[model samples]
Target: MTQLADQRPIAAAQEAAVDPAVNSSSTTTSAAELEQLRRARPRGPHRRSPLAQVGVRLALALVAVVALAPVAFLVSLSVRSTDDVLTGSWLPGGFGELAWGNWSAAFRTIPLAHMLANSWLVALGSALVTAVVAVPGAYVTARAGKRGARLSAALLAGYCAPPVVAVLPLFFLLKEVGLTNSVVGLALVNGLANAPVAVWLLDSFVRRVPVELEEAAWLDGLSVAGGLRRIVLPLIAPGLVAALLVCTFLAYGEFLFAVSFAQTTASQPLTVGLSLFQGDRTVQFGQQAAAALVGVVPVYVLAVVAQRWLVGGLSQGALK
Candidate 1:
């Protein structure tokens, strides 16, 4: 009887080893392990309900429409007759009645092609100047620690001051240098004025470049300048391009200095040339709109071409 009792206990032990149900501890351990694995698994973005998705899409569409309303109006105005434009019609009268001659008239009234060339020259020069000044400034500032902060503050302080404050001084300076009433003069002024903004933008990008790369270059026998040229500059090209585009846009739309500096048609940009559409007694609204549309084309094309780089450059360091 004692031997039978001992055999019964041995059989129970064997059953517990073979069957998980017979061993609660083993079952509990497996469940705990599974729970831990479930906790460790990364979660995906929360799935929105169909209704929520529709609402979000609709909101985006609405914002797009609102933002594009002015552009749509401009397009309509470009095709409208002088009378229709004067009447302030929201839409053009009819497709058949669209004044296609306004485009030709605009080209004839102003030296549109020449003004466009001048604008391009000024804008490009301004961008070049901004890059030349800002790139180095940004680099120096990025690595300068507290001194950089002070320098950046001073630069931005200059930026914060109204453009009007410097207009007289700049004009006189340009006049003394014989740059007044010239595209080159205008470009130089715009470029200098935009340098602060470029510096601010480019500093972020320069900071994004890893210091280890520069150290590696140094170990490879490259100087600071050489490393900047071959290593840092290439990595920050997108930011440089973005800064150039921003400066170009700013210079292109600058009217106060363009009007103040460029007195003759030879030196005037598209911004100044647009005034030619207005007369003492009459305004060529359709023609002006047509010319404005022409001016918008280059800017639009640039924005589209550089949109990706611009966004990336601007968005860097935002998260950190």
Candidate 2:
């Protein structure tokens, strides 16, 4: 009986151990099954509720309307009759009564074609000059150490000084050289004015490029300028495009310098030409609106065309 009792306890212990093993096996099987089921389950498309979708769409529509309202008003004013404008009517009179003559009058009253040509020349020249000055400046600033940083800061400070402060001095200096009332002189001045911003922008872009890449080129017997031309330029093409666009827009839209420097139609840009619509006693609102619309077209077109590059360039160095 003692032997039998000992045998019973041994059997009980074996069963206990076996039971835990069986339970663990079952638990693991169940967990694995659960995981498999989760994987096999179908995931439907994410969908907003109908009401939520409507609300979101409506909010977007409202934003569009608010943003476009000013542009719509400008268009309406440009096409409206002079009588309607003089009578202070905020709304259009009629589609049939629209004054197409306002556009023609604007062209006749101002040398619109000449002004536009001059503006284009200045804008293009400024962009070219800014690129020339800024690319080198940015390269030096980005590669050099503390001295480059100090120089960059000085350039920015010069840009931040009110343009009016330098206008008189620049005018007198140009006058001495017989460059006053000349498109070339105006473009050069615009280029210099915009160079600081161009340098700052290009500096940011250049810093994003790895210095090791440039060093590797040096090891391969490439000069610094060669490396910059072949490698750095291609890598930062988007940034260059953005810089040129910004410089062109700045020079194109500049009013203070254009008005001060351009004394005659020969050198006058569109911004200065727009002022001719204003008489001593009265302003031609309809003709001015038409001219304003013409002025806005190029910027609008550029924004539409280069939006992708602009966004990409602006967003560079934002992430690791």
Q: Pick the candidate with the highest TM-score.
A: 1
User: Which ten contiguous residues of candidate 1 have the minimum total lDDT?
Assistant: 311-320
Model 2, which residues run further than 4 Å from truth? 1-63, 317-320
lDDT for position 297 in model 1 = 80
Tens digit per residue, CA lDDT, model 2, 139-201: 899788678778888899889989999889999988999988999888889999999988878
Question: Compared with the true structure, what per-residue lDDT tens digits does model 1 show for residues 1-320?
Answer: 99999899899889998887769887899999999999887765466668878998999999989967766777787778888887866888788989889989999999999999999999999988888889889999888977996898799898998888888888899989999899999989999899999998888778888899999999999999998889989988878887888889999999989998899899999999898888999888888888888888878888888889788767763533
Among residues 3 or more apart in sequence or in different chains, the pairs in candidate 2 whose N, CA or C atoms overlap within 3 Å are none
Kindly state the number of residue pairs that clash in model 1.
Answer: 0
Whose lDDT is greatest here?
A: 1
User: What's the lDDT for residue 313 in model 1?
Assistant: 69
Judged by whole-model lDDT over C-alpha atoms, candidate 2 comes out at 0.86
